[model samples]
Target: MNESNGHFRPDKWRIYFIYLIAAVLFAVAGGRLFYLSVVKKDFLQNQGEIRAVRTVSIPATRGMILDRNGEPLAVSTPTWTIIANPRKLWELEQDPNAKTTPQTEMDRLAKVTGLGRSWLQEKFEVNRNKAFMYLRRQIPPQDADEIMAANVVGVSKRKEYKRFYPSGEVTSHVVGFTNIDDAGQEGLELAYQSSLQGTPGKRSYLKDLKGNEILRIGQDVSEHPGENIELSIDLRLQYLAYRELKAAVTQNRAASASAVILDVKTGEILAMVNQPSYNPNDRSNIEYDQLRNRAVIDLFEPGSTMKPFTISAALRSGQYTTESIIDTHPGYLRFGRQTIRDLGNYGKIDLETVLVKSSNVATSKITLSLPQDTVWNLDYELGIGSPVGIGFPGESTGVLPSRPKWHPAEIATLSYGYGLSVSALQLAQAYMVLANDGYKVPVTLLKQELPLDGRQVLPPRVAKSVVKMLESVVERGSGKRARIPGYRVAGKTGTVHRVGSKGYEYDQYNAIFAGIAPASDPRLAMVVIVNDPKGRKYYGGEVAAPVFSRVMEGALTTLNITPDLPEGLREVRLEPKVPYRLAQGG
Candidate 1:
């Protein structure tokens, strides 16, 4: 030790060494801070985001399907989807430190979500290794909220929608149904799926360990809701038609039935219905065949209904008129080996009587006398063998065979509506031509503000003549049962033998009735088809005509259509005269 300024001092080298060590330590710490802040910033941020950040989906609302009068047919209801991180759920359940026991927790979940406990447990075990799984989809929002309040670990609720049918089975075939994910499955729903479906949005959110949202970041994409659609169907008329058709089907014990009514002026379908329908809200008990829209899909021979077109063709040819005479002697006509016959000997009948009695032989003779393409060409111009073009799914263009050479049997059968097939919709459309005074209006299921210009498929005079002749059919002919009280109804009856695997099945038949109302000023066109009715009554007049009458009656009243029949001609409900004793008691 050396004494300086009367005090003992340590070595200078020791002080210098301590200062150098401190400087070195500060340099290392500064370099590490710079590297972390500049070189590895994005990697660390991404890792943290993976743990606490999530991309959440924002559900958009689906559009509503409304009837012509603004009545709701199909709608979307707010709902939630229950999902789970299965691995995390299993871990929490197995943890001895959990707040609730596994059995009790699962039981609570089952009760709240309406799921069986055993089923949930099995699903959990099956997906134990999956990071995500659906527990229950399209559950009611209230139930989902209740589940969320239970604080089940690794459980989450997502926004979703469930489709609801307001009219239930009444509009089932028209409005159709959606899947659990709010996607349209059939009918108009499937036809307009692209417009009916909405675009989902996305956003980033920060969630807590318990799967609860802590904060929501900015939205990455905007949600686009579906467009609302208005259909041409009138709910009032639809209900009436559905009720009458169902009653007819049940009473006749038919295999199936369909009915369609149109606004003649606008070519708008006012009501369409099919029997053997299913409830859109519940599909668990539904059959595949019940989902079909028979009015637009099923095809069958149009029977005597095609006679009006043939008669119109004849009138257009200037060779025949309403006063023209047709020889149907012996009630039958022979074409080679095939024979066309009538129910009775309607011999030497006039043009009107051919339709009045629905004489097949008379129609065959008239069709044979005319040019080869007369009837077929008229039928083609009347929208036969063509689609209605309403964008309906599975719409059929009923078979209209085009042959280079016509056989005598084919010509004979074609004259009586046997060689070609037509849907109820197509038949109705053809009748629309007669009702619209020779103009062929475009058919649609969408509401129209004004009447559209129609194509002139037939001459106005010929159409009017045919329509006038058709009035005699309901006045005294085969479609007598289709008469509506106080209304001058013009219609035709058709009874077709169903074709089986071999040929025509004699025991089975398709009973059809197509008609127009208020003959003085046509406003409505309707077609009814009852397939394979059992028992003594299977004719179009007895089966399908009655349904047309009942439905047309209610529809006329509902639409406030003016009655054309005179007061004296209108049917009166007679009441028996009260006796003197009964009058005294009253």
Candidate 2:
């Protein structure tokens, strides 16, 4: 309180010092503000945006799979995936102001999700420190809405898809199923995955302090929904084939079975089914073995079903005709240590009679006389030992022995379908050649606008002659059971001893039948294979041919094909039509 002036006055130096301090402070603040607002503006703004902006994925819907008739085979249903931020949920439970605990909300969630309370508790405990966890996957939309309406803190639901197989196990092997992520896993679903799958889009948005979306920044990419697939399969024929094959399998007590039907002219698969099929929709107790598409994936000896091909090859050689006779004396022939035998001594018989009797001895003689590679070339042209070209997964090209030099015994065995192997699909395709007048059309699963162009493999006259000869087999030979009323049926039967770890199992056999319907003007070709029948009737004619008869009758009628056989000549079908619901899917 020192007074320098005459009156009481503050110190002049102290006032000047206070003003200088004020100027310096203001200058520093102004400089810092200028630096932040102008010089460092872009960098600071980017950092701020980084903290506030969030990117989210916009899910795309998966495509549907339909039959040729527009019936749904595989479909994607809108579902939800429940997710939770465990840390946030735990924090909410600890907050005193919170109205409900995580446990209570979780209990509510469990009831709606069909999950046990103990499971939810375990999940909560296991992921308590984690920021995110899946609560339940692929729950119904209604259930998800109920859970979201509860507003259980960090718990939220995400839109997703669940694959549903409308035809269930009937069409499981063909249409296949998708994983929880909506990605295909098997069958046509896996084959056309890229085309059927959709591209997901991205969206950016501004989030608030509480992690709520404050503003949408617009999508960077537009979502592209998956493309729909329409298969060549006819659901009615698929159902018919599946029912008949399953019934035969159960009746024969077979280990497994497969059947395939095709449009002879178009080479389009109309129906394909396998026994012991697993439901694509429910896989809780699924067996991996049952998931195989045996029709296209499994290989077996085609047996006498190859006889027609041998005859066709022989006829094409110009050395033989339908009337060419082969002698099968004593019913057996010795090729070194291996002896090829027929059911009985068929004496001297014409080529048509050889097929009717299915005489192995006669076939071996015919094959031996033909030029080398004649049968092999014909088999190759017929798609034997080749992929069916339907783009199915794990399709076996089958085993066609290609050696620099072939043994006479090897040729004989191949003539009887022992050394070579082929899939049910390949067998069906080969028969399609005969049905389509020797033209080799490319087989497919996709629907066609018009019949695709086909390459000629055999002379049309030869094909027609074989088709006519096959009719006699169904009429009086081992394939009598395959005879269908009001239709001139043409088919061949095959019975092969299943090869095991050591050699062919004498007791176990594969029964097979392949044929065409309305033989006068063939339209449909089919093949049925039953493996390891435990019943007494294991022969192709006894077991597989019966299934062929029923399915062919139904398919012919369904297609509205004209009955070629006169009413007087058409015998009354002794077997009653099996009762079934057309709603079943294959």
lDDT of each: 0.85, 0.87
- Candidates' TM-scores? 0.87, 0.88
Question: Residue 327: error of model 1 in Å?
Answer: 2.1
Candidate 1: list runs displaced more than 4 Å.
Answer: 1-52, 93-104, 207-214, 220-222, 572-586
223-328: candidate 1 lDDT, tens digit per residue:
8999889999999999999999999889999999999999999999999999889999989989999999999999999888888888898899888987899888
> What C-alpha root-mean-square deviation, in Å, does candidate 1 show against the real structure?
9.2
Cα lDDT tens digits, model 2, 387-440, are: 877889999999898988889888887776778899999999999999999998
Error of 2 at 325 (Å): 1.6
lDDT of 1: 0.85
Each prediction's Cα RMSD? 9.2, 7.0
Deviation in Å, model 1, residue 102 alpha carbon: 5.4
Best by lDDT: 2
